[model samples]
Target: MSSSEVHLRSTIGGVSVEGQLHTLSVWFILALRLMMGLAFLQAGLSKLLGGEFNAAGYLANQPASNGSPLADLFVAMSEMPLFMEFVNVAVPWGQLCIGLGLLVGCLTRLAAFWGAFMMVLFYFGNWDVAHGYINGDFAYMLVFLSVAAFGAGRILGLDATIEQYDVGGQPLVERYPWTRYLLG
Candidate 1:
């Protein structure tokens, strides 16, 4: 009800007119982003370097291939040795991009989204055989999903700049509430 408060509430482009100092949540998000990014980067790099990487042999040995629906799909996909080689090379680069994006808080949501997708593939590929709740890959996917949902990048990332400037009063963004979640 004060003049100052009234002025503060006034806005130019249908955006909220308020500002607040950073809090602990911001730093926590940043840390989580960095760690998650690093994890992906490491996995990709390890696979590319051929440092004890053997997904083909491992997949062939999985019990899921014993007449399961997914077995055929997996076998067909894994049969292309060239495809596996491509993945082995591409995954490292994807990881590096994700790691840098997350660590720098640049395009954090996009990076997290891709990271989660990769984790999902890894989870399904291995968990089909484990057949239990004790899977590390599943947990990792959850972490990536969490990061994407929470929009960890905006806390201290380039995403903040985009949200504050580039996406002003966009109806497309309004319809997709999840974008707000990712933009933070």
Candidate 2:
């Protein structure tokens, strides 16, 4: 272990994991970022490339159940003609943009934030109450949040390139602290 490592002993469902935080974090963050990136990319491509893709049908049929608190919101969204039109375009494009950003590890923090937002909408605003259980959306959302928190792009991503200073001795991130947050 390196001097930076913090030893940890933890268990999940009776399985024990003993390791150093600094050592594990690097691998975990990179894998998590890459996986989440691939997943978003696949989903975005499927939606964008799919024929006659529309959010209306999915939004319109939200089980409309009293058990589902978000059902009303879904209904309200569906009822708005302009909103539906916007959603039809926005969902696909937003997914595509977020996916591409994450995949290349460009604008990593922004990509992670948006990815988490979408998963929140999917897990809480659409799927949770009706489904009666947490699902992959929750897991994926956590992964995205982890990437942002760990600044995973610095591990092996374009963000690493953007992080270094230029000949002017000013990194782009010097112009925007937020870029440092993304590249970290």
Candidate with the greatest TM-score versus the true structure:
2
Clashing pairs in 2: none
How well does candidate 2 match the true structure in TM-score terms? 0.81
Q: Model 2, stretches more than 4 Å misplaced?
A: 4-20, 63-66, 125-133, 165-168
Q: Report the Cα lDDT for candidate 1.
A: 0.67
Give the Å error, residue 148, model 2: 0.5
What are the lDDT scores of the predictions, listed in order? 0.67, 0.77
Query: Which pairs, if any, clash in model 1?
Result: none
Error of 1 at 12 (Å): 31
TM-score of 1: 0.64
